[model samples]
Structure formats: C-alpha cells, structure tokens
Target: MIFLMVELMLGVLISVAFISLLERKILSLGQSRKGPNKALFNGIGQPFSDILKLFSKEYFKFSVVSMKFYYFPPLFMIILSFLSCLIFPVVGGFLNMLDELIIYYLCLISVSSYIVIYMGWLSFSKYSLLGSYRGASMIISYEVFLFLLILLMLIYLLSKGQLFNFLTFQSVSGLVLLIYFFYLMFMGVMGLVSELNRSPIDLLEGESELVSGFNTEYLGFMFSLIFMSEYLMVIMGVLFLSGVLVWFSLLGYFVCSLIIVMVVFFRAVYPRIRYDMLMVIFWEIILPFALMFFF
Candidate 1:
C-alpha cells in the first residue's frame, strides 16, 4: 500500500515537472523567444533544476505570520490535490478504488478553495489578502456552474443507469450524449482554469496587480509546495475531463496532452480579464448556458 502511494506521488511529481517544461517551451514559441535552451537536452532538465533551486533556498517567514497557518495550508492543499488523483481509474492501481468519483472530486475542490483563502490570509500581506479575496470571489462565481454541470451529468448518467463511474461513459453512445459530454468538458476546462488560477483566469495571482497574489510572501520550499500542488491539480483536472470524454485509452492520453497544450496556449496568447468581467463571463454567459442543459 505504501509503495503504491509512493509510486503515485513520484509519477505525479515527474509529470508536473514535464508539464512545467512543456508550458515554458510552448510559451516561448508563442512569443518568438528562446526559452530554457541552456539546460540539459535542450531544456529538458530545466524543471528539475528549478526544483533543486527552490528547495536549496533558506526558508523564512514573516514575524507577523503564524507558523502553523503558514506551513500547514500549502502542505494540506498539496495532499488534497494528490488525493483527488486517486479518482483516475488506473489498471491494477489500488488508489482508484473509490465509488462516486465525481462526488469525491467536488468535495475535494470545495475544500481546496477555503485552503487557498486561508493560505493567503495567513501570509499577513495586503497583497495576499487582496489576492485571496479575488480568489474567493472568482472561485465562488464559477464553482456554481461547475456544481450544476456535474449535477446535470449525474442526472443524465443516472437516467441511463450508469452509476457515476468514469469508465461507464465509454459504452454509452449518442449524438446528444456526445454533445452533452463536450459541453461539460468545455465548462470543465473553464472552471479548472479558474479554479487552478492559470493564466488569463489567474486574477488571484495577477502579477502586475497583486505581485504574485496570495502567495506573494511564500518562498523557497514553501512556495514549491504550493506550486507543485497547483500543477498537480491542473493534471488532475485534465485527466478528469479526459476520462469523461474518452475514458482511459491511448487516445485519452492524447486528448489530455492536447488539453494541456490548449491551457498553455491560452496563457501564451491571452491577457488576464478584469475581475468584474471574469464574474460577468461566468455568471451571465456560462451560467445561463449551463442552466439550459440542466433544464
């Protein structure tokens, strides 16, 4: 059991590293700039080098910050992010044994929002507080759509006698079903981008305005934990959508890669939207469309 858990953690960590490298490469190409070319194998080693650099730095905390709150939220966030990966159905993997995968996922994500807010508040910085406020608002705005979408999916699946299994969608077939799944995937991508605080949607970490946002005060190993957790959540979100759309196949992996590329592509090409506009996009446009499906 322990070995399996360790294996899962290593796999997630390695994948996170490569995804970071991939994002850098893609962003560089998008901007017509050289990126990470000095590292081993034409920048293949850049992510690991970054990991080392981060861990090697001396740890410090603000005098106003509580040690427990400063340390615990990042660690807890990462652990929850890791646990969410267990919902991915892996062959012979003991960790994916859970039932009602969607419910489990929703619970984890809902909890993570609070952790993000807490982590920010714990930093004792005005920038962090502002970022946390933005983060909470953004999350709350989009999370309702996420919940409704999932509920719609759960209802459709139950109507079809499918008991909330990721693998069950593979056997079901229809134009309506395909269109519905695609809609969910679309909203899932948007929600995940917002939830994970990725580019454009990353108002919580708006560098220009908030100076790294909620994590402004975090550095070194502490920052790395938060960083790793965010990337892991990205992977988990992509995989979840892939499972919904394609199940666990070679094609599913391809789809997952494509989604990751799309995420990086958005980061490369788009500018962050205003927070009010972000709220409008979700509440006015996305939410109504989601409601149409639900009804």
Candidate 2:
C-alpha cells in the first residue's frame, strides 16, 4: 500500500510537471509565439528547471506577524492538494475502497477552501483578505452545484448497488442518465475550475485590482508551493471528471486527456470575467439549473 501510494505521488508529480509545460506550449501556440523550447529535450525539462530556479532563490520573510503566518498556509495548501489526489484512485494498479466518494470529496472541498482563506488571512493585506473573501465565497457558491451533481450520481450508484461503477448502462433510461450525468459533470468541472482560480474566472487574482489577490505576499519557494498546489488541484479536477466518465474500458484516459486540453483551450481563448458576473452565473444560473436536475 505504501509503495503504491509513493508510486502514485511520483506519477502525479511528473504528470503535473509535463502538464505545466503542455499548458504553456498550447497557450503560446494560440498566441502565435514559441514557448519554453530552450530547456533540455526541447523544453521537456522546463518544469524541473523552473523548480530549480524557484528553489535557488532566497526565501524572504515579508511583514508577517509570526512564523506560523509565513509558513503554515502554503504548507497546508500543498499537503491538502496532495491528500486530495492521494485519496482518489487515479492509477489502475492500486485499489481503494470504492465507498468513500462522498467522504473524500467533502474533505477535498473543505481543505481546498480553507487553504484560500488561510492564505488570505495570513497575508495581512487588505487585497489578500478581499481576494480570499471573494475566492472563498465563489468556491462555496459553486460547491452547491458540484455537490448536487455528485449527489445525483451517488443516488444512481446506490440504486445500482455499486460505487464508482460507470459501465452498467443496460437500458434506455440508463443511457439518458449517462448523458445527464456528463452534462452535470461538465458543470461540476466548471465549478472545480472556478475553485482552482483558473483564467476566465480568476477574479481573486485580478492584477488590475487586487495585485495578485490572496497570494500577493508570497514569493520564491513559497509561491512555487502555491503554484504547485494549483496544478495539483487541476489534476484532481481531471481525475474527478475522468473517474465519472469511466465506463467499461479505458475511456477515463481519453476523458482525462480531453479535460486538460479543454482547460488549456479555455485559458488561451477566454478573458477573465468580472467577479460579480461569475457570482451571478453560479448562483442565479447554475444553482437553479442544478437544483432542477437534482429533482
């Protein structure tokens, strides 16, 4: 078990590194520019080089009140993101008890949400505070839709007396349910992206207004940890939707790859939206639609 866990963690780290490179390459192509081809193997080693750059820098203390304030949040963010990934069964080699989906998701959301609040509160800047507030609220708002979608899936799974089983579509109703499930899953993915503070909804990091938002005071290795945490969250999101899309075969792989591509496409194509507009989309639009689906 320990070996499997270690292997999974290593795999996640390597995948995340490559994913970072892929995102840069995709975005660069979209903007008609070359990206990160200077490193080893035509920039295949870019993530490692970037990590080395961050680690070589001196970790400086800002106007933080205590050592705890300076260190705890980023460490917790990294740890929580790690934990979220560890709990999910990403690789086929390891076996996890399939019944803990609810518990796992609840913990993932709670810890992820707290990390944002922790960063904002610890930073001791009004901008961080405000960004944290917005981030927390936005996350909580979208969380309702996410939870509803998950609950609907759980209900279906429970009725079938199976957990995380997506291949048993043996009827017309089942087919319809599968379609609806993916529809809700897409919405869930959007909510997850919002929680991760990706582009198009990155109001928390509104540089024009918040000056990098909740992470304004973070620098060097500290900032790298935060950045890695964000990447891990993105991985978690892919693992999640892919897990749901798993049906009979290795479709999860295709689903997972598609999601990463879609996220990069979104970043490349979309502009950051207003925070209020985001809130409206979540609360006034998504919530009601999700509730209708739930019923």
Candidate 3:
C-alpha cells in the first residue's frame, strides 16, 4: 500500500510535467511560433531540460524572510496538492480507504492557495506582494461558487447513500443525476483552472501586467516548485473527475495529455479577462447556474 501511494504521487508529478510541455507546444503552434524546439532531439527533452534548470539554479535565502516562511510555503503547496490525489480512486470500483476522505480532500486542496499567499508575503517584493493580494481575493471570489459546486455534488452523492465506495459509477443515481453531475463537473473544471491560476482565468501574475506575479522575486528552484505545484493542481482537477480507480496509471496519462492540448489552445486564443470582469463572471454567471443545479 505504501509503495502504491509513492508510485501514485510520482506518476502524478511526471504526468504533470509532460502536460506542461504539451501545453507549451500546442500554445506555440496556435500563436504561429515555434514552441520549445531547441532541446535535445527536437525538444523532446525540453521538459527535462527545464527541470534540470530548476534543480541546478540558486535560491535567494536572504535574511528578509525567515526559514519557517520560506520552507513551509512551497512545502505546504505540494502537501496540499498531493493530498488531493487521495480522494481520487484511480482504479475502478476501489476505495482509497481513508475514512472522511472527501472532507480531507477538500481541506487539503484549500490549503494550496494559502501557500501562494505565504510565498508572496515573505518575498518582500512589491510584485510578489501585489500578486499575493490578487490571488487571495481571486480565490475568495471563486471559492464561493466552488463550494456550491461541491455541495451540489455532495447532494447527489448523499441521495445515493453516501457510500465509501466512490468509484462504481454503475449506480443508477449517477445516471439520474447525469445532467447535474455534468454541470457541476464543468463548473468544477473551471474552478480548478482558476484555483491553479491557469490562463484565461489567470489574473494574479498577469505576465504582461504584473511581471511573473507572485514569484518574480523567487529564483530558480523556488519558482520551479511553484510551477510544478500549479500543474499538480491541474492534474488534481482531472483526478477529481476520474470517478473510478480502474484507470489507475493509464488514465492519468491520457486525460492529462488531453487537458494539456485543451488548455494550450485556450491560452493561445483567449485574452486574459480584466480582474473585475473575472470575478463578476464567476459570481454572476457560474455561481448561480451551479446553485440552480444544487437546488
């Protein structure tokens, strides 16, 4: 069991890295520019090259930020994102066997956003501070709808006896709740993108506007961790939709690849929304629709 857990996390991490590379490539194509095609073997090794850059680079350990703040920020980010996988039964008809798993997953994923705030607050850079402020407010705005989205799912889950078995979608309830389930899932998907600060919904560190957002002051490996954690949450979103553990390792690869292309296209074509507009869109449009599904 312990071994399986480790493999699961490792697989998730690798999958996320590959997805990041895929996104870069597809977005490059859409923008009519060559993506990362310079690495070993026509950029097949670009992700690894980037990883090496992250591992080999230096981090700022100035006296401005205490060791506690610096260390816990990224650590907690990974911890939170990691725990999200636990709630996902990757295989069909199997239970992850942690009682209160649904509740635990919610708590865990919620903590990831806090870590970003910590990173910015500790960095002592204006851009970092501003990014953190935006991120905090952004999450609060979206989470209102996100929680409603989850509640709707829970309502459906409860209507079906709330069993420990989260897999087994063979239930008639899934069929009965199909419309609501799909609607909630779509909202959840959008919320997941916002939670991870993906493009189209990303406003915190708008590259053109805020200059790398929260981690502008971070060097090498620190940003690497942040970057990985972002993709980690993206994968977590896909895992949340798994609904069964049967796919196990295979499903992780397939869905992540598909999402990479989708997000890449989304980024290539869409302009980032104004911050106020982003908030209003979520609350006015997504939230009410999600609530309607619930009630």
Q: What are the models' TM-scores? A: 0.91, 0.88, 0.86
Where in model 2 is the C-alpha error above 4 Å? 90-95, 161-178, 244-249
Reference-based TM-score, model 3: 0.86
lDDT for 199 (candidate 1): 89
**List of clashing residue pairs for candidate 3:** 89-245, 90-245, 91-245, 91-246, 92-245, 92-246, 205-213
lDDT of 1 by residue, 39-141 (tens): 8989889999999999999987578878987899889989998888676554345535455656778889889988889988888899989998987787779
Candidate with maximal lDDT: 1
> In model 3, which runs have C-alpha deviations exceeding 4 angstroms?
90-95, 160-165, 168-183, 245-260
What are the per-residue Cα lDDT tens digits for candidate 2 across 1-295? 6777777788888888999999999999999999999888899989999999988888665655576666889888888877776545444423244445456656776677778887888888899999988877786687777777667766766677663532221112223333656666567667877877888888888899999999998888888989998998898776665553433446656667777888888889998888788888888988887788656
lDDT of 3 by residue, 114-205 (tens): 77787888888888889999989987888787767656655666787766444432122223333446666556667767887888987778
Q: If ranked by TM-score, best first, what sequence of candidates would result?
A: 1, 2, 3
What does the lDDT read for residue 140 in candidate 3? 81
CA shift of 3, model 3, Å: 1.7
The local distance difference test score of each candidate is 0.80, 0.74, 0.70
Error of 3 at 15 (Å): 1.1
